[model samples]
Target: MVTAAADPTPQTADAQPWGRVDDDGTVSVREGDDWRVVGQFPDGPPEEALAYYERKYSDLASEVTLLEVRHRRGGASAADLRSAAKAVSAKINGASAVGDLASLDARVAALTETLSAETETEAAAAREAVDEAVKVRTELVEKAEALAARDPRTVQWKQASAELSTLFNEWQSQQQNGPRLPKSTAQQLWKRFRDARATVDKHRREFYAELDEAHKEVRDRKTRLVEKAEALAPKGEEGIAAYRELLDQWKTAGRAGKKADDALWARFKAAGDALYGARSERETADAEASREKIAAKRELLEEAKAVPDERDLAKARALLTGIQRRWDEVGRIFPREAERGLDDDLRKIEQSLRTREDADWKRNDPEQKARANDMTRQLTEAIEKLEDELAAAEKSGDKASIAKASEALEARRGWLRALGG
Candidate 1:
């Protein structure tokens, strides 16, 4: 509030220097250096007229003060405050108000300048936000396009689908929370993201559809295989061979899905287990029947090791021959792997005997002995001739011929030594 005394010696804004009440009841507001008649107030006294216009000045001052406070507090936008300030300034200019109108205009102009800089700062921040938003959206678009470009045949559809969904969710979140992007950039990115998402979805659907068809084919084949195996159940133990053939076919059959394959395999395996169970019962009987033979063969095998230990080749052969005769008498055993194992053990003993016989034959055979004796005779004759030549060279004092003859004679002696002659 402002008050003025009728004295005109000195004034301030509070002293109401800008307002005066005329003796004729006219109210006036001051511009910089001059005063303008605002209105006539004949119904009031000088003080009342001045007070009336001063109240108007107070309202305008409050508006300016409010603008200043709002600018400091920073909830309202700077541009909005600047607009309000312009309106306030218009009201204060040439207003029928009087307490320091010039000062209010100065405050409004100063506030407008501050607001202009604040508005620029806000615009720069918005641009930065928009740029950041574009960068984020571009990354999302690139990632989606990368996913879309994968080979559908090789893609792990479940994981890829989940990843695509997550990327889409991220895109939506950014769209909702991030700053607005340029229309062109936003539309382009969305088109790329949408196209890529649609492509991934299309590929996923087609890939799964093909996989389901393939699974159906495999399922039908495996179902028929199960039926075939089940049909073999009536053959009991005799059906094992046929069941083995069906197993081979089953291995060639492509996979159905895990759940379906597991269910189908249970049926197939149950059928196989039935056939094998019958086989197991027959094997148990055979094993019982062959227990005696297995024991007998085992005993013979323990004794057969002596065949290799025998120093006399003839005795070793005789012992192995007797063991083989006893082995034949014991006859076949059960569970072919066990029979094969036993046969292999015994065959190893036989092979040992054969190897010993071969070595002994090479040592004492008449033909080989005769050939060795012939080679010895040839070497002896050659050695004797070389000795005579060496003696002649040495006696004649021919150093070159002596060395040649001595070297040949020494080589022949070494051959004789190697032959143990």
Candidate 2:
């Protein structure tokens, strides 16, 4: 029996088989025993070539299986064999597989191209939408600016213009940035905008008509008042008072159109000036006469003041009463001379009597001095309070408050005057 060599060389195997090609284009095989060649072939077919390799390596399957097992068990690495197997598989199936892969890649490329084209189309549509919105916004902004420039004093026109302007702004802003609505919504919005504008225009026309009617009424009323004033102008004090009343009524009347207001005011002022001018002339003549009478009374007052000191107090009082009656009978003096005339007369008489009274009081009692001092202090406080009230009234800028304060000041002054200080 022969033992397998320690090296297991193929040269020392039981048979050494070699392959050759036959004349028929088929492969033939020969065997070598103990390393001696036996046969050759004329031609070798691919299958015969494969068969020759198979027979010589009859235990190839088991060797491959053992190798895979060893690789699995981690006894040896099968990386190179696995790579070779994959390469063989790729070569066998590569042609058929490439057609499907190429078709899938083409489909993916087509999908990418389609998506890019759609994106571009969408972008262009968005740009168009934005441009349209901008146009609407610009138009609305111009309209609103024009409306805002209108005069606010024209109440109805201004209000209508403002409302239209606001609506336009709202509509434009909504179109630009608000939700996208359907055609019906757009139609409804447009209709609303049109109807609102129409309504405003109609209302404005109506307002102007009413304003015209009102102006006519004002003109008629003012014309009647002017006629009444002209009729009453010749009557003396009665005419003056009546004309003043009419002036007051005119002031209370509401405003008319600019031309009518100016015309009416001019007419009213002219008529009033003519009437008052005549009355003023008459008053001046009367005042001059009254001044002459006041001068005579002032001479009489001087005479009364010159009355010699006497024990007959009753006769002195009677003469003073007569002088006061004469002063009263003299009536009003000219405003400029009145104050001086009264003050000079009263001061002379008061100084004379005050001297006599002081002498008399000194002869009688010290209690009278105390009473006068108390009265003086009370009057002074009252006057101070009155001045404060007047100052406060002026600060408030109220006619009614100032009037009330004036009355209080007068009352306080009356008290002071009665104190004979």
Q: How many Å off is the CA of 39 in candidate 2?
A: 62
Tens-digit lDDT track for model 2 on 1-421? 1111111223323433233334443433332222212223235544444354334333333333443454446532233434433443343222211012222233334434444555566667766775676456445545544444444446568666676867676886777775464566467556655664565566667778888998898888888888888788567556878888998888877777899899878888887788778868877887867768777766876768645454565566667668777777766666656757676766677567667766776646768777877888987898898789888989989789889889988887888787676
Clash pairs, candidate 1, are: none
Model 1 misplaced stretches (Cα beyond 4 Å): 1-30, 34-77, 94-98, 117-160, 163-167, 178-214, 280-291, 308-312, 334-345, 388-411, 418-420
How high is the CA lDDT of each candidate model? 0.88, 0.60
Error in Å for residue 82 of model 2: 48
- Candidate closest to the true structure, highest lDDT: 1
Collision pairs in model 2: 21-41, 21-42, 21-43, 21-44, 22-43
- Per-candidate TM-scores read 0.72, 0.43
Please, what are the lDDT tens digits per residue for candidate 1 over residues 1-421? Answer: 2224542223564554667777778787767678788887887677888877778888888899899998898899887898898999899888987677777888899999999999999889989999999999999999999999999999998899899999999999998999988899999999999999999999999998999999999999999999999999999989989999999999999999999999999999999999999989999999999988889999999999999899998888888899889999988899788899999999998888888888788878999888878888999999999989988998999999999998988988888887668
RMSD (Cα, Å) of model 2 = 24.7
